[model samples]
Target: MKKPKKPKRPMLAFAVTEIDDHTGGIVWARTKKAARIKGAARWGYDEPAYVTCRREPWADRFHSKPLPVWVMVANGWHFDCLGCGIRIDEDLPNWQDRCGADDTFRDMLREARRYRKWTPQCVIGHQHSDVFCSQDCKDADDAYRAACKRKEAHAISVFQAKVLKRFPGVTLVTDRDRMHPHAYATSRKRGIVVQQVSVEFEFPGMRYGPASLRWDSPFSSSYRKVEKPYFSCCNGDRAAFEAYAAATRRAAQEPTDRDHP
Candidate 1:
């Protein structure tokens, strides 16, 4: 969990400004422990919000000790794409390129954050960010997943129609929340695969409504087919997918073709 960086505050006399506890004003140092405070004085604070470093005028008195680097420098921040694993130490704003900045970790530092805004497609790559290096990395991980909703919906319409057409009396059962969603299709309440929901078909005395399934392939999952049912984000309906392999194993089936007799 990354915390938001607070806005830069001005220093009064510069002893590593920190929030004062007693006076509810700026304390001189990151913290007593972190800043290694040597000496300090009292304060005159009013209603104190969160422990924030307060800004004060120029110091009319003198301090005994000096402070260390408690602030972020122009080249202090660093980042690696959690998705692509690229040490984004330079500027990269293009989403189409294989590796480039998308402003995920823009500026905790300084120069490279801005100048590179004009300089796209850096020869060597190394940008600064907190977590993900690029926006593409985030999307690849589906950070903002609109999901394969259209595909799932299409499967539902097509498969439901297919099942109903084959047997009018047979009923089709569906529950979006039959299973939990995974990286491919998430939400325990939503039986989704990648972006589509699982489905099922039932006979006159069979179960209808809620069902779950997953069909795995490199194209759909966009990678290796995982054996774990839940881990499989295979695109397509799950209605009877789990039963497919077993059914095939039990019966040696072949495509039948009519010959001209």
Candidate 2:
């Protein structure tokens, strides 16, 4: 015997009435029960969790009242296939219908034995992104980010060597300590620090760049930002600290008001 199909209900906006919070999330669903499920799922909780969902009409508008008002909320999550850019939401029939004639989604179900997502990653290192549709896309992105990071590390080392050699006493900054660039330098005036040095400054293979050097201010208890680097290296090479060194030299040579007196 052929099973009877469930009649489709009109999707409408159902407002969740809250007790304490004035603003709550507006959920769209066909029925009251569907609203509860969808809204709870959206908030990463069970249907009967903290939210006391009610069957409010679609015409209900959210207001800025003190308490017990219809509320709408959102987390700003994008549920789309990273590789193909298709809207991926298993709970929504409309979203599922778009995957017709494409078996990639089915493949996702078959292989993802533990967790199903347009969310999980292909590798441990890929945290900035997770909604890949295929292993190929994930691997490619992971490899690309790794390569770019390698380039950045290379650039950092190159900058460090240049500073240490070019300026006899100038040293490299370490992540852990606010160690001065040079041994005798006071805490108020550390020699030099490289910042925002990344491989993606070049993009493509994204091999790093636009590194800047800033010195600790002798006048104040803050690091002075270099407004204009004498030399900016997007690829993280040559003249990385030349402008900084020159500026330091110039500042040193200038006579103070005490000299005039």
Candidate 3:
């Protein structure tokens, strides 16, 4: 007998509700539960764990808030063709750090795996992963809290530079408010350490640009085959990006009746 289809629930993450494009169904992650687990995983214990989903290619707009939330689904270490399965930490007795924090990350992962249409990769917080800024910290002392905030921001900048080098032709944009006076003073007062040299201001053909250039055509256009959607514009090794551009140009040059007439 065919199993009955389960009713679609709104996918929610970072306290934001998810809306499915195909089914037009709305999904919001159980944020309170997920956040509780996530916080517990990261700050509340010796080691933290939680389950989350890889944000699909284009699921950012519907969020009432800004883009790039930290909540994600974590499938354990195993993979079953589609992608990696739930992390091995889920059921093991000493799974949290013993299994790399997969157990604590398991709550939402179980649900995502049942669907089998998506995958997971761990996303640390904004400072660690370049997502967002969060003031939520266990340290209640004002000075300590201020210092941590600066640390978080500094971590983000270091990671940002690393990402830029890893992805060529990638463009990144950050808000001005991110550099507000309070942010700078806090960093100075706290004595933030510079880990890596900042990304070069200019690299040949790799100037900062709009985010649109990151995604390639999912389908073949009249002109050429497009590339897949990439996380950042800086993707593609030297050879790959060049080859793609050459092919696109060649396709564009093809003689067309419309052009000649």
Best by TM-score: 2
Best by lDDT: 2
Using lDDT as the yardstick, the better of models 1 and 3 is 1
Candidate 2 segments exceeding 4 Å error: 1-78, 81-86, 89-129, 176-261
User: Cα miss at 56, model 2 (Å)?
Assistant: 18
Instruction: For residues 1-261, write the lDDT of model 1, one tens digit per residue.
Output: 999999764323322222554222223443333222322232222322323333222321222332111111112323444655654533344323432464343332333442334322221222222345444445655643454554445645644554444344444655447533222444334433443333455443223332323333333534545332221113342434334433444443221221000
Give lDDT tens digits, candidate 2, residues 68-171. Answer: 11111012222444544544333322343444465687665544542344332221222123455446655766665565555445545554554444443443
Clash numbers, per candidate: 25, 10, 31
Q: Rate the local accuracy (lDDT) of all candidates.
A: 0.36, 0.40, 0.34
lDDT of 3 at 110: 49
**Residue range with the least summed lDDT across 10 consecutive positions in model 2:** 67-76
10 residues in a row with least lDDT, candidate 1: 252-261
Which of the two candidates, 2 or 3, achieves a greater lDDT against the reference?
2
CA lDDT for candidate 1: 0.36
Q: Give me the displacement of residue 7 in model 1, in angstroms.
A: 27
In TM-score terms, candidate 1 sits at 0.30
